[model samples]
Target: MGCPLVSIIVPVYNAERFLNETLNSIKSQTYNNLEVLVINDSSSDNSVEIIEKFVKSDFRFRYFYNTTNQGVSHSTNVGLSQCKGEYITFHDHDDVMLPSKISSCVEILENNTELDGVITIAEYISEDGSPLGTKTALPDYITNNPFFVRAFERSYIPTWAMFMRRDIINKLEFDDNIKIGNQDADFFLRLLYRRPQLYYLSNPQNRFRQVSKSLSKKSTSTCEIYKKHNDVDIAKLYTQAGYSKVVIDYALAKANLWRENIESALNYIISAHERISEFDEEEKDNVYFIYATCLYLNQLFEPCLEILQKIEGKSFRAETLNNQGVCWAIFGDLTKARDYFESALSILPEYIDPKNNLFALNASESMPVRHFTKFPLRSVYKTI
Candidate 1:
């Protein structure tokens, strides 16, 4: 019945610039019962000195150092092994939590006995801590049981925005083998499989610092690394949980398509289409859109048009029409492309891509149709 202790595990690696601000945010939390575990991952900078300062000032602050530079996963696992709180959470060294973050999450979990974890919205901030924007860990449509599918589609859940019961934390381990990225998604998928009742807190109480040199900001090669290392393991995990392989294939296909790996995307798309019965109408249309876009990208204009025709729903009509316009533009049929773009604009009058395509077609001499042809269709699809 007393205020349960919360363990905040932060992994630091040469984060000397932001370490003071980050620790100060935690130290100023509204909730008093907290054990701050700052895992020093062989930081060569004055990160250790800063952490030692905090330890000297605060009785609740704990610091542990790794012998060598292991990654975030390993450092976090070390913190996990050492934490002795009833509830557990994670903090990134560069990010800062609002004062109310701990109190809000702790109150929710304590009151809702059925909930295993709670997630809050993240406000993205620049290096100087200026506000960029806000993002939710899960979309409006995703809740509780559908978290696995949503996490597979996109790993939007920020680690710093989550608070979990210690038992739930004990049930999962961060996969150290996932070196490149998306280790959180892999761990979260496994956790969701256990059917833990999860809750979403929409308040923007977590400030996520978006640094240009972060791993996610790296080149497309990092994405390829994630696909190679973690995608297969995630797919296998979903399969073992009795979910259809088609779902996994669909998500993988989208990821490959996003990475512009046309051939791999096509393979997964084909596999998903072969088991089309596994998806509902809306999901099927989404798959159709991806399939059609792939065909159009490969310059298979006629077949791409054929696949787009099979899309039955109104949900993706504007996107379908815009892609149809792109296909026509690439095939050098400017007049037909203009028509499709106009039709798409009729559906969604402010649709940017189609509007731009229409402008390009009409002003052909100023902006040659060939220019649109060379433009990557994947970029256009991303806007939708």
Candidate 2:
């Protein structure tokens, strides 16, 4: 089989530390016939030096530097415009693509010409390259039809793991206005209207280092999530762009997610009890606690107690007991509340929640003396 022409874009900022490893990994890829483009987004560090070294040593590597430090989106767009290959993918300065990453993605694009792009799960790693074990599973595609839009949301997919046709790249430009992040997500979401099928690697296909200064840490919440807080507008974007069903599905899913957040943060029992079935069974402690606490707050005592009883471990290991105390205290039953609070304290002695509940249950306005100094209160006369 003839090898496909692939363009790999690497946007450099201050990537002096990990850039070499990333380049080496790419060069070592089993697949050849590759054009590697490095866009030096005006680095004041050794990134340009490293790029120069790579370009000087290899004919396949080409690089350009920006006069000023435009954000990543701008740099990516520049590289996108310059890519002459049939298939394209971009990598951040610090992240590493597996040796098989490009070849594997390219093959998928070739075989599935209908795909706008291919994506895969990224194995999250620390600076030291130890796996953090965070992964998004992609079971739906292999078992079900993947050439549709909604199938993409099974997990978080990023640009590094994706290879798109140059035609798709030509039609879309990275939105540079988002200084911190998420322009790619928005652009990709817009494309889902066409029901572009996306293929992901069977496993995490790259190593994504969790650096302190990555776009995630620097970006606004909206940018980090790559979703607008107001979905109606985003839905409108998808609707106008062509994928009306995706908009609807996103709206429904978003509503459920928000409901989860609210359920997780609930402080009232009665209100919470009404939403019990909404809680996913595998939610973390915070999620369950929020739901149960809300149920207690709403005065749905029996159901609240029942759910509270089911909770086993969490930051709120004491939540069931503490909130039970609330139910008792509100019903003119201070004794029962105190007992429940004490039970909570027994389960987690260091936690302040149960302790605070105890103080409130006892009608003691004075909170614990958080700091204490102890000297011999009385002078020791002699060894006794």
Candidate 3:
């Protein structure tokens, strides 16, 4: 037996500009046993001609075109319906996959039996493949942990960076409703909420092209329409992913729903009422910390103190002490806040949040500070 068969689905629409580079990247992957499916989703440009060119030139590629314009999810489902490989991955037409991408994913997935999927860090680049400073965390979006270095929250998780077992997605399909933006987020969140075994490679394997015209990257009015649709999927994901703490999830979900409801920054304060009753001491304290911060940011310190009081003098942990101190400082209790902050600082020097929050609190306190964990996080993936 040779290498396992892998199927790569490329959904195309008005991608004539970068289609060749994307296709060429797949063709040149170090892993040779693969099928490339290029679904031309009713392109209005020369994309059809470009697909035709690849069809003739590369025997490894097969081309399909829809008579009408279906969205990327539709095209993706069409490609998936045609897959016969043991493993499958999606490659966006405008992105580039490094030579190691396929081989490395193939290597890892073939060995790890429990992982439902793998994610990788990817770069933001202009149309010509020049890098932009924007970076995202793939593990954050993939894993269940928030505030962890799993995936970055600032940007989107590119569709091209995941390697998934075809069977895990068996009978599962992308929601066509999220047509314009965050299609990958919808898909991955569903996978994680339903299946808990997903892990990440932690390095960039795909170059996510941020061609200015890309709908997901736009800031115009049309993008607002796109964002509402994206939030729908996120809210759906939150229904289950937020089960552990509805209050925390509600705060995060509202933050996620920011575009649709412009006053979300205030709604987080309202979470105190929406939160489930009868929380344990720890649970209530955690919820209060998130609540106090939201109130402080929205300049509602009176309520912030109401929550902060519950956590103060409770003697939880160093981190908790620090958070309570910050809230008190915001509530104008400079003396009390400094005591808690100093005590927390003495207990845990490595916890940076207290240090930063305390410095911001006083604009006058001094402390020696260094942040690391012996080995800094260098790559999400270990090298060969």
Q: Which stretches of candidate 1 lie over 4 Å from their true place?
A: 136-142, 219-285, 294-301, 305-384
**CA RMSD of all predictions:** 6.2, 12.6, 10.2
TM-score of each: 0.71, 0.64, 0.62
lDDT of candidate 1 at residue 231, scale 0 to 100 = 59
- Compared with the true structure, model 2 gives a TM-score of 0.64
> Number of clashes in every candidate structure?
0, 13, 8
Error of 1 at 173 (Å): 2.1
**Residues forming the 10-long window of minimal summed lDDT in candidate 3:** 370-379
Error of 3 at 127 (Å): 2.0
lDDT of each: 0.74, 0.62, 0.64
Model 2, 102-220: lDDT tens digits are: 77777777777676677676789999888887564545242112233332222224567667777765667667876656655655655554445566555666788998777657653
Measured on C-alpha atoms, candidate 1 has an lDDT of 0.74
**Candidate 1's residue-wise lDDT over 51-141, tens digit each?**
9999999999998999988888788888889999999999989898999998988888887888788877789999999999886334422
The most accurate candidate by TM-score is: 1
lDDT, ranked from best to worst? 1, 3, 2
